[model samples]
Target: MCGIVGILNRYEAQSSSLHTSLRCLHHRGPDDRGAWQDEYLQLGHTRLSILDLSPLGHQPMASEDGRYCISFNGEIYNYLELKQELTTLGHSFNGHSDTEVLLASFAQWSTACLDHLRGMFAFAIWDKETQNLFLGRDRFGEKPLYYWYDKEAFYFASELKALLPLLPTVPELDPVSIDLYFHYQYVPEPRTPLKGIHKLPAAHYLQISREDWKFTPQCYWSLENIPPVTGDPATLIRQELEKSIELVLRSDVPIGVALSGGIDSSAIAALAAPKYRDTLQTFSVGYPGRPAYDERNQAEALAKSLKLPFHDIELTTEALVDFFPSLVAAVDEPIADIAAYGHYSGMQLAASQGVKVMLSGVGGDELFWGYSWVARAARISELKDHYLQAPTWKAQGIRTLRKLAQHPLYQKLGQSKKVPIPIQSWFRPGIDLSQMTLSPPDRAVFYELSPDFVEALTYRPHLFTQSLWEHIPLDNPYCLFPLSPPTTLDIPNQISQTLFQTWLVSNCLSLGDRVSMACSIETRLPLLDKELAELVIGLRKNQPDHCLPAKAWLKSALKGILPNEVLDRPKRGFQPPVQEWMHAVVRENLETLTTGHLVELNILSKSFVQALRDEFSNKGRHTFMLYKAVVLEIWYRQIVLSSQSAVRI
Candidate 1:
């Protein structure tokens, strides 16, 4: 909902640098801006004005005794309840803004206050008395916080752009992060593309004290540690979702829903319609002439049944071409997914209508078993484990069949390769594992880059050398986190947790925040509410297989609330015409890389880049991979090379 930046300098801090950084984040909060400074620290805030629309709501707000001052981003949905409790404990406030309540809560309970919060947030609270700074992110990372630390100073910001200017020079490119970006389309958390910059991971907080000038990030919450709860899961899920939606509706500005034809959005719209009634608005997007990829009609019918207003936007090829660069800039990183364009357009439409907040249903699929591949993989993993526990001869026979099944010729014959039970396909995008060991059920989950590509990339005319690749261990990328392994839970639950922690948190949620804030509108995800997530996780543990029926429990819970047509329809994700759009975009920009910064830096081979563009134009087999390469090149030029004060790559 806003942008926040701060600097803790080892020497004198400048107000000019703080204001300049805030200018870069103006789009995130155009309503108001404020800065608080002292000898050793400075905090700046850009306000979006969703909660309290008065001068009293201004941030860099301080406690009554002037011992604590804070700058915060995101909504704390349960702020009213926290305020009521704090009132009983003798805390008073002049304004009803969540920011005031958050500062008071911290003053009362310190870092333990995080346990009571139930909404998305990333905030920093500075204690003048103790000379300590506390930084925290939401439980699921719905908001982002990036930081750079050194002996000279420590800098933090809501977005990476704000921190770049404070650096003495452009940070060096992190090759490991670059390789991770190529593998996952987006770099994983706790690491950014810049060598010294790091993202504070979800469910964690950092405490920096002036006593020693040392910072240590500690985890405050984790899905792996959630205690089991027993109940009528269907009813509990419905109640929790409604409760979350009601809290998310706490805003001074008009709110709307980003509805799709799918059950997730449809259910949210249905639940929210009665709360706002005729004032509620809904928005959807589709390709201009691609009916197969369009869901406007379906969304319109659902909106009509609820008697709510509906708006649809058509995305043409020309518009996509024009907005491509802006989209890359908004994303801040190269996210190869085309769905980001759809989200960007939808948010732009909503913002144009003067709406400030929009509710989405992003986490439903990850919470429930929405993706068939994940469910199938879980089942396959379970079956393989069961068979492997049999007698030695039986296990050996099964292993022989697994070897044959993994053969390149056999795998090619099948329409879809039966991914090794323990190896998640999502983590190994565009990777070939023929040379790796393939044992049943117990096959190592780690994977290496393809030998051919490695050989080619390590040859002359490349930015990366062979030694860098050799240094990266072939461990599963998921191992990057210290959380418990997915195998600790049931197969279905394991897959759900993996997707939620990695894909949903890193890719989907990051995209939602960036693109929506690009237009200065705030997005709320009801399905990812802390209470709702806890209920869903408890339900999965109680009935793992029962909960794996592609949102079957959710449909049953909302049987009367939503239209049967919407619930029964198969899941068709928001699919854009990426093949056609990418081909056109790539052909148009292909020549840029021939002499552009990426080739000039020797990170990429011009001939290889030419081959990729030509192949995509001729036959669109590697559309996303090629698109990712193009996006990386553009991002590198704009972010790293174009900065007047940046260091040369």
Candidate 2:
């Protein structure tokens, strides 16, 4: 896990800014830094030295012939295996580093090497032989790649700070994306808050060269393409998870687990503690005064039971408010998760303790049926499908005849009359009389914006300023998500797929990467392992026996591994005291209305700001909505307004 930046063309003009930008990512990789320049391209790398601590692990690493140079940012879990395969094919390496193995695999197979990789990665490989540049992201988007393009010049970076300096001019804020920020708490892929800048969607890749300056992104993998798994789900899930954990634990530096009170983190800690050679340290974050919000007590208990060293940090409301500004800077993306500061503070604590790599249990919830609302959504979406279907002609006609026969007037006066055709059905609207008009199901059934999207609808229109509305008259946020599922998937499986695409990829996974990297800590999520996700999802999709309630599969699988109490306890996720935290934070930062860029730029109106501020001061209504606006305002000031030099932070 490191930071990588590369320019396809115009190397001299961006050289100074490039170095400054790379320096800004010193936190991401402070061990060593390298810069490689060619007439056509310039590549920079900041090394964290996870796999090999020797100089041989240095990057912007080139092939033996110097034909292919790579600036890679993530670990390929199967690099050892790939290295052996490449060596058998007559390729040899000087050092025991994954970087060497990756460059060799690319040299031997080109983009086909992606098929052999099984890990989180966002890398840039420049081929001097063809003057081509290729960029790819991991399947679950555990790693992020942001890029900006033109006909001749192309730039890519792991984070926005480094990529911002390479742009010719600053891009304007995208209103549509900002609206989505309010709706989903983060901008969904492939649009960032800025237009023309994009996040390469998960499971996709892009490549360009001097001949074809413009290249379209291509999707290389998807869960829908894989066949379902058979047999006992618990056994299959456990086997796949163990394989991933074993491979993920192969790291040179010390590793720890982000232990939480919840089942997901406990399960990871339970599995990893036994496999590691030394005792693993566990970290957790909590709210000092808020009992409902803090779960460190339980987390500490789990650590004691596992016999691992434990550490924790308490984020007071004051600390949350004080770090709000830097949190936006660290996040880079204007996500509105209240617990983001917790991820940031926890990493700082871990880094101070000399923990380099951390394992987290992020994807466990999405793979299993963990979210209550998602389960409800699957059932509601099915009900909506039935509601939207139009009545057939035969069914409507039979109903009309029955109504007439039951009427008092028909029974008294026309009971003896033959009444060949029912009056209501005398005339057919369609010439063929069997014409059926179908109404497509509303996408809103499957789409939502958190806590309660339906409740949000009651006052959402009032929150957007009139001037902002005029600029984006056709901004329908629902269009950002998939409306229909393939015929092959069931409702629950399809809902899980959409969450993976939207909530997990764009919000949860993206936020996780930003916070961890901010403190120079690498977080590895084993549950997103290709084989593990495939097997669990495939089992849930096809097997009837696996159709249990939220997290039943995971609970059953870890019954013996984890304490029965740990597996059976209700899931209490990491949540902060939102009403108190946001109300206090927004009240103190209320001047965002007067001194903020959103107001100065006419993106937000004075009236709307005053109304939101009033609510925050009095009843604290729309706390989430108000907090979302405040985060955006701070982001604009801290990031965009200060973007004259991207490395200012």
Give me the candidate number with maximum lDDT. Answer: 2
Per-residue lDDT of candidate 1, residues 513-551 (tens digit): 999999999999999999988888876777775324588
Residue 62, candidate 2: how far off, in angstroms? Answer: 0.4
Candidate 2, residue 140: the lDDT equals 91
TM-score (C-alpha) between model 2 and the true structure: 0.90
Off-target runs (Cα >4 Å) in candidate 1 are 11-16, 383-391, 400-471, 474-491, 617-621, 645-649
Q: Put down candidate 2 lDDT per residue, 1-649, tens digits, no spaces.
A: 8999877773333434478678767878999999887878888889888999999999889889989899999999999899999999999899998989989988899888888999999898888888888898889999889999876578788888777877778789887887777778888888899878999899898988767586889998887787877888888788788889899988999888898899888988888888673747999988777888888999999999888999998888887888789889988889888778878888899999898899999998888878856665665454444434536775566445545555565444332335543542343122111211122344524555254444545556776667678756453666654454336676666677888998898888988998998889999999889989888877765773223567888887887898878887787777878778877787778866655778878777667778777776787676777777888888877776677755431
Candidate 2: RMSD to truth: 9.0
TM, every model = 0.89, 0.90
Lowest lDDT sum, 10 consecutive residues, model 2, at: 428-437
Q: Candidate 2, 226: how far from true, in Å?
A: 1.2
- Candidate 2 Cα misplacement greater than 4 A, ranges: 10-17, 277-279, 389-444, 455-459, 465-467, 471-475, 485-488, 544-547, 645-649
Residue-level error in angstroms, candidate 1, position 300 = 0.4
